[model samples]
Structure formats: C-alpha cells, structure tokens
Target: MADMPDRTGPVDPPGPLARLLHEALTRLPADRASAGLLLAVSGGPDSLALLLAAAELRAAGRLAQVHVATVDHALRPESAAEAIEVACISNALGLSHTVLKWRRDGPLAGNLPAEARAARYALLAREARRVGAGALLTAHHLDDQTETHLLAKARGAAGAAGAALAAMRPWRDLEPGLVLVRPFLSVRKAALVEAVRGQGIAAVDDPSNRDLRFARARLRAELSCQPDQAQLLQALDDAQAQRACEDAALAERIERLTRVGHLSISPLGEFELGRSEPVDVSILSRAVTAVGGGAYPSPRGALESLVHRVRNESDGTATLGGAQVTWSKTSLHLRREYGRNGPPDLVWPAGASQACFDARFDVEAGAEPIARLVPYGRWGRGPLGHRTLPIGVNEAGAIVAAHPALRWKQGETPPALAVCSRVGWRLCADLAIEARSVLTGRPQNAANRGEPVGKGVADTYIRGQVEAACVARREVARAHFQDG
Candidate 1:
C-alpha cells in the first residue's frame, strides 16, 4: 500500500493518487511537465482531491511549482464564498491562490453551462499566462468521461463519430503555450471522494450536480439509479479501440499525401490540393474549418455535399463554415471567406504590445502604437489582393503597414504577426508545422513560436488513439486492484 502524507509539520511519503498524478505529469513534454502548473480547483471533491494530491507531491519534492485558481462565475450567491474557501485552503497548503471572477457584460441566452465553461477557460488562460504557468489542471474523472460519451450519443453522434467521442485526451493545448491537463480522467469519483476525506477537508458538494436542470446533471441522475458502471466503461473501451484504428489509418493517408506533394498549406493560411488529387473528406473538413475561421469542422452531411460539388463542378466557388472553396481543373483552393462584414478590426489598447486578431494571428505592435487593425482589403489591395489579410491604419485612416504575413509596396514594414491556425492542430500537428515551414521558409519550431504542433486535422483519429491508450491503462490498473 502507498503511504499517505500527514497534514502536520513533517510530511510522509506521497500516496497512490499522487503517484497517478506524477505519471500523468511525466507524460507531458519534459519542459512543460517540469514548469509551474495552474490548478483549477472549484472546491468540489474531484478538484479538491487533485489539489491535495498535488500539494503532497510538491511538498515531497516530486512536483514543481503549483498555483491554484478558483473561478467564480457569479452564477450563484455562494460561488464567491466558495472561491474564498478554496483560496484559504490553498494558502494553508503553502501555495499561491487566485480567485478569477467571470464578469458577464450581457445576458447569455443559450446553453448556460457551455457559456460558463467558455468563460471559465478564458479566465483561466488569462490567469495562467499572467502567472507564467505552462499548463492548467482540471480534475475531470472517469464519471465525467462517461457522462460526456452519453451526452455526445444523445446529440446524435454515431458510427465513427460515436467512437471518437468515447473519451477525453489526458492533455491538450488550450493555446500555443498553455495546455489543459486532466490528470484524473481515469480515476473514479468515488476514489476522489475518499481521497478528499483522507485529507480531512470538507469539499463542496455543488447542488448543480444534482440540480437536474442541466443536461449532464440529468444524465448523471439516470446513470446513478442503475449504475452498471462496468458495462458502460466496457462499451467505451470498445469504441476507443475502434477510434484508434481509424486515427492510425487517417494519419497514414495524411502522411502519404504530404509526402507526394498532393497536400500543402500556404502562409496566407490557404489549404491547397494539387490537380488530380483525391479529396479526403476528413482532410477537406479540416481545411474548411481552418480557413473559414470556424471553431469546429463543417457538418458531415454538408461537407460531403460540398465534396460532391467539388468533384463534379469543373470550376466553381462555394462557401462552407465561413471558408470559400474554389475549384478549378488545375487545383482546389480554400481560404477564409470575408463576406460583407469582413473580419472584425482589432482596436489595440494604448499600452498593450500584443493582441490576437481574428483568433487567427498573434500580432505584436512595435514601437509605433497601432490605433486600429483593419482588413488590408479596406485600403484597396496589397500584394495578396484586397481583404487577403489585415493592415494597421492610423487615426487619419492612412495605411501604416500590412499584416506580417503579407507584403505591402506602398506601406512601411509590417508588425510581427504569426499565424495561429483556427483549425485545431491536434490531429495533424506535424503536417501543419511542415506545411507552414515549407510555405513560409520558417524553421519548424512550433513550441517557441506559439504555432500548434500535432498531426493536423485527423483529430478524431488522434484523440481516439490517445483516449484509448489512457483508457486501456486505467482498465488494467482497475483489474489489478480488484485481483489484489
């Protein structure tokens, strides 16, 4: 049996949960694993358990610096108090704590949970960057994964998609530098409850978990009634295995295409397919989302329809997921479609040196303070034509320069701008990096430059592979515990 650390002056050896956390942390890239971590503790049992385990590890010199952040969404009257309680606990444990408040400027109408979640992550990301943390930790457990699978299924996920939704990745990039890590996804909620009890802390039991007002809560209620936990997990395992197979095959295809020069992405963020090249739906979906500036890939049915049109039509243009798709006998082109509204102009704060524009590029305003960043198209045309990218305009509306991605003959030197691909790089990060390197003549270093690293667009496949491996290991561990 693993030794549990005492809460007194002298600490004992780290416990089993701490060991699990160590394992998870070690799985990250060495630099990130050793760097400081920001723990998102909500005072809930799972998060509290994570905090306790991490604190023990830190005290034993098994972990690096740890910071705690409790987000007060201000949805309930008790939320602020709960955040304070978490802060007090963190202080007693000898860790720095920050309470980030989510201030809602307007009334949010649809999907309150989803909205809150987005806000929470944004706040956490801001805090993490400010504190120089490499990664943020969230205590999502096995029960959460099961609930997610059930929710996805209820939303009409089926076939390969259903398989892909079976589980969550242990670690994923929240942005270029900051990663969101779930160390306890494989741990059961019951184990976490026990761990918290062992720590002699009273964890918050959020009424929302049993409120039944939310979809996940309602699903949790149903699952708890006749909890055939083993059967559900077994089904998830099966799905995860299927997802791994799909991802491997997809990765192979992407590698082959890149090797053969059939696939390439330009510095202007255009995804191009060579003439006579076969159209892979998965690859096309990623290109469309990346170029279209959409958060997710285009819907499957609509994407398939677009593919059919691309194959049949000799030369035509179509819009899907905010990206314009133009096909010709020679090649197919996909780029961001700026309609009547065009891209939103970025108003640079007086003293700020950096700002993300269109969620697509990281812009650095040099010595000259940028008054406003307008679409390059607004000032007629640059090297890439009108609206190809953004440009800096002064108060008098004179074009100062183009985006770092483009060249301007009449304008001064552009500010430093680097592409942050709108399309997620989880699936084909390597390919995306290579394509960017080949097209832009830049070194292939995604880590330092804030560029994404991964396969590219085979997210479903890669996610499946990662989740399956994680699930398999946890299952083996569970069986071992039972046998012992």
Candidate 2:
C-alpha cells in the first residue's frame, strides 16, 4: 500500500475552475456519484489541474473517494523521477496515489506514438480495476480536441476526422465496468495551466509535445500562427452535432436489419438497397466484424465490393475480416471461418477462476484440473451436438469437458460452457438503443434511462455458467465419496 496523505485541513480554493469541473461532473451518469474515480496524472499541467478540480469536488462531497495514478512509460530517462514527483503532489492533495509502469521490453513496432498511447490506456485501465474505480479521468481539453480535428483533416483521415469532430464524450465505457471520463473537453489549455499555477503546482513539460516529427506537434505549431481559431472551433462544434445525428440514424437502421449471435445475419433486399450506400456498407461492416471476432472492421473497398455483390447477385460467398459471408436471394449470412486457424489451445490450470477458449466460449473449471482445453477442430467433431465451433478438453481424443453441452444426457453432467457473446451482444444492444433513441427523440446515452443496456444478458449468461460449474464440482465430489 502507498503511504496515505494527511487529511488535516482544506487546501487552496480552486475558484472558477472548481465550478467548471462540477458542471462537467454533473453531466456524467447518475451512478458515478457513488462509484469512485481514478485520475490519470502525468505530472503535466493539464492533469495537475484535473487533480486539483477533482480534489475540490471531493471536499465539497460532490464526489466519492478520488485516487490518482501516474504511468511511467519508461521511454524517457527522467520518467521514473517524474512519477515520484506526481506522487508527492497527490500526497499534498490528500489523495491516494499509485505508480504504474510499462514493462514492455525491446523496440516497439515502429509506430512509437500510437503504441505509446495504447500502452498508456492499457496501464490506466489495469490500475482502475486494481483500485476498484469505476471511472478513469484524463485531462484532454478543447485545445487537444482542436488539434486532433485539424491533424485528421490535414491527413485526409475521414474516420479520424469524424471522431475528432465528435471530440471526447463526457463518459465512454473503456471496458465492461471501467468508464473513461474527460471533464475538461470544453476547457482551454491556458485555463488549466492557470489553475495549476494558482495552486502553486509546478508541472513538467514533455519535450515530445513540441517535436516537429510528430503530426500533432506540427499541427500545434501551426495553430499558434492561425488567425481563425474561433471559426475552427465553431466548425468543430457544428461537425460534432451533425455526426451525432448521423450516428443515431445509422444505429436505428442497423437495429432494424441486423441480428447478432453465433451468426451475424441480416436480410438485404429492396428495403436495404433503398437506403444510402454508406449506411448499408456501415451496417454490413459491423455485422462482419462482430461475427468474425475481428478487432476491426474490414477495409472499405472490400466491404463496398461485397455490398455491390449482395445487391446485384443472387448467391455468392466472400471472406472479409476472417468471416465467411454467404448471401442468398433475400439475406446475408456471416460466420467465423473455422477453416482459418483459430486461437491456440488454452491451458485451464487447476482451481483457475475462469478461462476463455479461442475467444468464443467462456470455460469454467471444476474442483480438479478438469482438462486441457483444445480447439474442437483437432478432434474433427463438434461438441454438445452443435455445429458451431465448440471447445473440448480431451484426453487422447476422448471428450471429457465440453462447452455448451447441447447434447448432454439427462443423467450426465458436463463441464459448463457458455457462448462469450460480449462483442455480439454489445453490437446489437448499441444498435437497439441508438434506434430507440432516434425513434423517441432522446439522446443515445439517455435511451436506457440510467441502466446499462445489454449488460444483464452477458452477466446472466456468465453467472449461469459459473453456477453450473459449481454444481458439477459438487456432483464430482459426491460421486467420489460414494465410491470410497
């Protein structure tokens, strides 16, 4: 445990900055008031200001316990010392602090900036989970958002441009439970610097921010000389509003036509073809990605070709994003390509809490080791009477434990297996919620009325699998006792 700071007296007042932070905090989900927050501080001016504002909120009882963490990417020689300095500042504010390190060895895959950003988020997420914090806060502000939009425009990155225009949301789910929050999206960088200076906190400036080799740094330099700052900001705001409307409309169309499960199926006929090509292509891309379990959607060129075939041709087969797409006269069918090499075997060690096999099924173990999990393809057969790709723990080709035991006898018990439908479930749920929002004229995030949509199904399925595993373990114990 890190050393706890003294909670003696009130610190310096944050003045107007405190008010701004409170307003942003109020916009978060209602449940956030109870769920604690984790601040990702880099000892920079922006993050230091965020920490101070959050501390004020904590003092006023507007927020629950607040914790701070600094990541040492280990890329710079002075990063370790800088992390220690952040700890001291956190201590001054009477907040618990943690130092997380990036332990990746060897050179990165050439994209240093992108890799570093990903690594930073991964570290922050792990720390958020460790501290049981529901929300992770960063200090990204309006200037950063503007820079992002301009950079995307310069590079002709339409997708990145749209994302930058949308800017950072008040809250986004980083994972299943952890939400990332950026309260300073509307605040200016100079305002944050002033706030940190008012608190007598000195921040370290990372030299990388000004490096001309990076696109963002070059954009930042150009912005200093650009006279149309207000116009640029206004354009960004308008773009964000338009993007929101487009997203809601697209989500509605997707919900109407797509069904996500073991197979992401959608019916395409005159009704779908009647819509704009962009909408049709977007929905199909999401479907293919969901079914294929790919990290990203297929390229636009491939998706456009597939869309054209689906509209014109009667029957055909195509592969995109590791998914086999087969279309008939009326509908398109997408499923994982089992012929392609699946994920490697998973070792379910004894007493392991849970294991995932091939990223498809959730595997729970019994009291003993149960069995070493292998792909069903190795045995040249499906498990539990289902043709879907099933996983089985085998001993020399004899099946012992199988997930989704669809064909188990009435008197026989088998190790539990449940479809890991998180990806598919989220896809469907997001579309459904967005569609409802568009229909009801409500905000997309507000459509669920406070509760997370689709969480219940995923949670219920996993809980049922865990409970079944417990019963199996108990049954095995009872049988052993009877034999003894």
Against the true structure, whose lDDT is highest? 1
Model 1, runs deviating above 4 Å: 1-13, 29-34, 275-277, 312-315, 345-354, 365-374, 379-388, 392-402, 405-465, 477-484
TM-score of each: 0.83, 0.71
Model 2 C-alpha lDDT per residue in residues 23-66, reported as the tens digit of each score: 44444433232255789999999998888778776666556667
RMSD per model, one decimal: 5.4, 14.3
Residue 367 local lDDT, model 1: 61
Model 2 regions more than 4 Å off: 1-16, 29-34, 158-167, 254-279, 343-419, 425-484
For candidate 1, write residues 401-445 as lDDT tens digits.
565666555645555543344333422532222233343333322
The CA lDDT at 402 in model 1 is 61
Clashes by residue pair, model 2? none
